[model samples]
Target: MEIKAYSRITADKMVVNGSTVYSSSDGENINLTDLYRHLGIDYPKFFKMDNLCKAGFLGAETIIRDAGMDTVTPKKDCDIVLFNSTSSLDDDIAYNNTIEDDANYFPSPSVFVYTLANIVTGEIAIRNKIMGESSFYVLKEFSSSIIYSVVKETAQETSANAVLCGWADFLNNTPDVLLMLLQRTGDGKIQFTAENINKLYR
Candidate 1:
């Protein structure tokens, strides 16, 4: 398998396939609403998503688009494997802070829903109509071995021929996402491996 395309979403920029899609000096937080508008996407549910889901959705969607596709791979052939350093720390902290003070406690169902890191995967899968294996992992730090191993294992265990896998972390209001669309057969631009993954990650 090899990486067909990728998208990197950061504080002030959106890059797809090594080209800068958008850039700004607006500091750390990314404005997902503005990005969705810029992409000419009409997905109404985007507004309801948390930061992590937004980043994952945008990154995956952008890369898949960059790969020149209208019809997605069959549901059973696509898999989503994601990794994050903080898990749902950002959302969890926000939710906790909202209810920390008894005098001004507010428990939002919307906010509560984003407390799971895997929910990002669910949203993306739903959008792409994918029904294959979906998995999420929390790491103290990035590990190419973990990524390579799990992805390879999933491919071996399931009918996955296309895997959307990578690091999508939304922490401190800044998103550092790198979503790679891996295919079992492609141009072979760079053979998928632990070394190559770590190299691209940096």
Candidate 2:
């Protein structure tokens, strides 16, 4: 298997392959909703997710779009594997903050829905009708070993034919969402390897 397409979204820039797709000038966190709008994506549910999910969701959406593989394989053949340092802790803290002091206590289920890291994968799966191995993980930092291992293992699996995987790491006020689409065989520039992943991640 190999990477058919990839996209990286930093705090101020969005790059696909070696080309820049979008760049923000204000130097703030990337406004996911606005970027989604600019991309003509109007999924209302996207607005309901926390920042972590938003980053992952947007990254997956963009990569799949650029790859144009929505119909290349059956829905059940698609998989999504993601990794991040913070998991959903950012949203956990935000959800906790809503009810910490009690004076302004508010516990909203909408906010509570994204307390788990897997919710990011869930959102992408739902949006794309993906029915294969959807997953998410936490790490001390981006590990090419972990990404390479999981994708390689999945490639050897029997069911999955196409996969969207990588680091959707949104944490500590820095967002790094890099998603790569992999297929059994395609016009992939390079084969799947830790070195190739590290090069594109940078």
Each candidate: RMSD to true structure? Answer: 1.7, 1.9
**Error in Å for residue 111 of model 1:** 0.5
Leading candidate by lDDT: 1
Q: In candidate 1, which residue pairs clash?
A: none
Model 1, which residues run further than 4 Å from truth? 26-29, 69-74
Candidate 1 similarity to native, TM-score: 0.93
lDDT of each: 0.85, 0.82
Question: lDDT, candidate 1, residue 142?
Answer: 84
Clashes of each: 0, 0
